[model samples]
Target: MNERRTAVPPLIVTQDNSFFFEGAAAGRLLIQRCADCGTLRHPPGPTCPQCRSFEWDTVESSRRGTLHSWTISHHPQDPAFEYPLAVGLLDLEEGTRLVADIAGVPHDELHIGMPLEVGFAEHAHGAVLPQLRAPGASRTEEGES
Candidate 1:
């Protein structure tokens, strides 16, 4: 029997941000750091905004962060996500903020400053990305939704 598969759009990986995806594929969360100014940035860029330096390096995150903000979405559903999806803005221990899907904790329990950690999950198209979870949550499980 022929099976139909839902395909998530492929990520547009560019030279500036390839490291981020590569890291996630390797079960790591890598952030770009400006070699000259020691500033950290997310959504990896070609040059550091703080110092406009082309020289940069990667830092492995502690994978721990506080929930700085969050929102739940319910409309315009996509095949890659579940309904009532919870997404969060996390303030990482290393001083950089990253946004990711929140899981393992109910929507009501999520609060500002609650501790969470980064975990990798395979999404549509088998792309690995970070998912935020409550501390001590299992990482071996596949992403929900």
Candidate 2:
């Protein structure tokens, strides 16, 4: 039998944000920091909002964070993701917030201020990306239990 697979979206990697994707592929979490004023930012950009400096560097995050907010997405289902998907906004210990998919935790168990850790896994399209999981939880590359 011939089996078909869903096409997963690809990440838009640019010079300004390549490090973040590279870090995820390497199982490391990196955050962008403004070299001039020591300000950190996410969704990597070309200039620091605080200092307006073009120079920047990366810091390795602890991957430890607290769930600041979250949501369950079930509408307009996409083949790339599972239904009732748990996504969250996390406040990393490094002081920057990141949005990532939550795995291995039941939605009812998720709460604001709950501790979480970032994990890397292969998403659709064979892209490695960050995922939020309970501290010490182990997940396969496919992000299954």
For model 2, state the Cα shift of residue 11 in Å: 0.8
What TM-score would you give candidate 2 relative to the actual structure? 0.89
Worst 10 residues of 1 by lDDT: 136-145
Q: Could you estimate the TM-score for every candidate? A: 0.89, 0.89
Candidate 1 lDDT by residue in tens digits, 43-70: 7999998879999999999899999999
Maximum-lDDT candidate? 2
Residue 90 CA error for candidate 2 (Å)? 0.3
lDDT of 1: 0.88
lDDT (Cα atoms) of all candidates against the true structure? 0.88, 0.89
The residue ranges of model 2 lying beyond 4 angstroms of the native Cα positions read 1-8, 138-145
Q: State in Å the error of residue 110, model 1.
A: 0.9
